[model samples]
Target chain A: MDLRAKLALLADAAKYDASCASSGTEKRDSRAGGLGSTEGMGICHAYAPDGRCVSLLKVLLTNSCIFDCAYCINRKSSDVRRARFTVEELVRLTLAFYRRNYIEGLFLSSGIIRSSDYTMEQLIRVARTLREEHGFLGYIHLKTIPDAAPELLAEAGRWADRLSINIELPQVRSLKELAPEKDLAGIHGAMGNLSGHIAEAKEARRTPTRAAPPRFAPAGQSTQMIVGADDSDDRHILGTSDALYKKFGLKRVYYSGFSPIPDASAKLPPAPPPLLREHRLYQADWLLRFYGFETQEILAGGEGGMLDLELDPKLAWALKHRALFPLDLNRASREALLRIPGLGARNVDRILAARRYSSVRLADLARLRVPLKKVSPFILAPDHRPARGQLDSAGLRRQLLAPSAFAQAAKPRQLALDV
Target chain B: MYSVTLESPADFAGWREAARGLLGAGIPPEAVSWHSPAEPAGLFAGPPPPDVPAQSAIPPVPRDFLEMAERAARHSDPERFALLYGLLWDARRAPGLLRTPTEPRMARLEAMARAVKRDAHKMHAFLRFREIDTPEGPRSVAWFEPEHHIVEAEAGFFQRRFAALRWSILTPRRCAHWDGAEIRFAEGARRADAPADDAAEDLWRTYFASIFNPARLKPDAMRAEMPKKYWKNLPEARIIPALMQGASGRVRAMLGQEPASQPQPPGPRRRRKD
Candidate 1:
């Protein structure tokens, strides 16, 4: 099939992997036609180091695979239609769409066919073609195959602006049980190899003779873990990710909710987890990574390893620790401001910047993009303060979680997380 | 349906007041964002307009002015932007924040954008050139583009940066392509020069496919975020039909529960994260 045909088939299949991002280079449309255009906000997203969001041309090289990982829809055992694309096909699609001012660059992954080395090599070739043959300075993200050879893995590094290896199932035992062919040790080994290359490349960048060291994927490496495919608790999942980040210099660890495919293992159950569970996990993840709250504190927000689906993790945390309430907005450190559910890191920065020139009031905080309705109970501003004794942790939890009289029995209760 | 009026000439202040009037009528901000790049060529003058007085006490001007000047250089429309700079950022201070939505904050942002455009045009005009030889032949290059004609004004962003490289900004609307030898214009009407309606538009098709996140596809919400007007210019816009056609299947998938008939081991009931 032609590049376009392959792209249509592969991209359609790949859309199921929702790690949408398209940023890295600041390259704008200076020439007559090139793909990198920053002029329009269009639809580019980037993940803040704390995992906000980033834009990239995220897609798969192919959906064809050799192994039947039960949790994966595209696994070999599944009946889902599959397709693969050549390196040139992806290069053409990425450059063409980019030139027409469509996206920032490519995010290519694949299901292993033939062998891990062969698949990884094909993915690497796409990046090389865009960079070397086309002088395509746009962002290139190649998903790393954890089982690929270490040397071929080195080539993956030389081309991609970012590399990611999905951790599949969270628990090692769950991974072993669900994906008989997959190995956690191999995944860790790939991550370790990427780290060594990136470090070496950084050092090489300093030497004039080292051909400029090609900036070795400045967006950095990231991984994704499929949640709910096993009984691994929230604590265990976060712990796995935390270890990945600290052990290897990973930029992100995405959570792909396990969407069970057909002909799946009998060991796997039928219904998917609540979408709210994934949302709660993201909120909890944000708390641990950015808000200085440990995984222990995040896990504390609910009844068990599960988080409260109704309230956001931060708000749930604040309810559990009422002593932290009425946090002085003026005196609170950056870390404290981040802990507030409604105030994002960007808003925190804006608040800090605004406060430098003038004293901030409750209204001013709102104008600065603070979610006043949510943060009100937790923070004290120059003009307004929450009634300190109004609600204890248990009292507030009851009030927050109570069924709103406005809701009909048939209608789903709208939670603060929804808004 | 609303759009910014640039067909007729108006200074930055005059434009701001008009936008505020429209904004008060409860219109979305997107309704009036697009306008002419900056002060139009017809508006150029020998001196500052009567309204402009002197520089303000504000510590520093926004970088937008410098950016505008660079764009103007590429277009080579210096006089228009010079007069715009003289009119918009004179010694006097800008108005304090609008007391209420009565003045429309988003409108003010656009008007300020217009002011920057005017000043940038002026800088684009005054940019000097240097020459160089390449396999392609001699070319003039200068590295400078700012919203204001800071090139002519006191800013000196030019001499410092362009001292080594031979490149020039072929400003936004107008051409400022520099061959190391001298700067030239790739002038004409703005044309994207797209394929002839059906000239093998596969890359765009694939690009549209790759960028569309099935997980986050919100039809009405997406249409709201990216208006229908801009779709014709994007490749992924074509996928909207297929997307809508598949919307029911998608909704089913998003809302569907785990398959029940399959037998499984007795462990923690594994819910699919779908």
Candidate 2:
């Protein structure tokens, strides 16, 4: 097939692995000698209609696989047209797209072709060529084959800015039922090895040494778990993510709501999960990582194991624990202030700074653009306080709930990441 | 009242020099008026700002205030200069004035600075280059329209990223060019100066169309980040309307079909290296 046709097939095959991050890497520029640059922040060059950031040229090497796993479009049983790109062709396409400012860099993955070791070598060759031959200094994210040789895995890390291996399903039972070829233990073993290398490289850079510390995936590794593909509850999903963060030191755990694909397997659910579920998972993940909330504390805000679709995870948690309301804005500790519904980390810092000069009041909150109607009931300020018994009233949740677009219609709406 | 005319609309250095003279002379902000070249002179324009005595000592402003003022000065707001000077004048009496973000005037200045920063970031993300044959070699060129005076400030980003390629970025207010060795600035040019199309954009559009999942269509989210203002110049944007129009049909096709039975694993799942 021609290059354009191949790109269409490969990109379509790769779209199911929803990760487009290009940030949190060592800073480099082309001023000294190279063709591209990467600041600390990742830039989204475009937004696809799926409401996803097109930060990288995400594509696969080939769509032909030796193994057959359900919930995948490129499984051996599926009759989709197959295609692959030569190493040189893939490298040229990356440079062309990078030069036109269409993408940050290449996010290369592939089906299990020939063998795991052979597949990994092909993926590494593309990255090594970009770094050594072209002097390209942009971001690169490689999908490491979990069963590849340790030597090949180490070589892959030297060239890639980040590495990833998808867990695919949250529960071990679900993984076995849907994708029999994937082993949970094997995936964790590979992640453990990668974590050691990343940590060792980081520690080496910290200490005094003349030679440059051995580079090994400076941006670290992340994983993705497909939601709605199996019968896994939010509690189970979050429990798995918490373990992954603590055990593997993952940078991110992307929750991709299973979407319909052509010729899908009968083992998976017929209908896709609500997009809001995916969005709520992201918010809860943020709270777990940045907002100092335990997984059980967040899960307590909802019935069963699922998050409340009508409200964000943070607001739900606050409504559940009403005894913590009406904290004094002027004298409250930073941790206490962070529990308020409408305050973000940045705004919390701003409030702390502003209060040092004078007492914070209702008018001051308005200048900072804090949602007064939402936060007033939770905070005690000089000029504003919740009415007597207002926080204890049963109708408070009804009053604070905005008209949800997701609740109004079955049609898909925007899934924003903000809390 | 003292009237001060700056060198240009986004001239932070000129504004700083003028403000320092007035501050050292003990002039109040209400008695001084600021003007950029774009604004017409007021009907009873006062004399130039008074000079400061060499012996007068000016209080040291916070480093954050200077950084914020430099960014805020690039905003298109006509009163930005006066607002910045007002805060700088107030800083003398209250050393913590700038730190109090809840203050109204300080909040306004901070909003202006945030707007300029967002504009610069969008410029860095949305600018696209197309290749054209030149007498020297193949050169890449792009056309952009910025909402603020950020072309000069953002030029270094392009120079550092594309240091090896000869490229030119033309905007309505200013243009920047890099020829592998150094960067040069020139006057504004029309859109006609830039190439209208490139051969690679077709492949890019195809990749864009295929990567988007139709079942999760959310045009509002896409428009929020990549707005309608940027659609005209983006090659992939031309196909967005068609993509959105056809999304429901494609989704219906997927949902309407019967689920296929799971495929059995092929012989010997793992193929050892020969």
**Chain A TM-score of each candidate structure, as shown:** 0.84, 0.96
Docking class of 2: acceptable
Per-model TM-score of chain B:
0.35, 0.88
Runs in model 2 with CA error above 4 Å?
A: A405-419, B40-45, B257-274
lDDT score of residue B129 within candidate 1:
35
Off by over 4 Å in 1: A1-5, A25-59, A203-211, A260-265, A391-419, B1-198, B202-217, B220-225, B238-242, B250-274
Question: Each model's C-alpha lDDT?
Answer: 0.55, 0.85
lDDT string, candidate 2, A1-419, tens digits: 99999999999999988888888888889989988998877888888887677889999999999878899999999999999999999999999999988888999999999999999999999999999999999999999999999998899999999999998899999989989999999999999999999999889979979998989998899999999999999999999999999999998898988888888898988888877777778778888887889999999988899988777778889999999888999999998888888787778888999999999998888888776777888999989889999999998888878644322222221122211
By lDDT, the best candidate is: 2
Error of 2 at A296 (Å): 0.6
What would the per-residue lDDT of candidate 1 be over residues B180-269, giving only the tens digit for each residue?
A: 344444432232321224333555455454445443333543432234544444334566678556534543453354223222111111
In model 2, what are the clashing residue pairs, if there are any?
none
- lDDT of model number 2: 0.85
Q: Fnat of the models, one by one? A: 0.06, 0.63
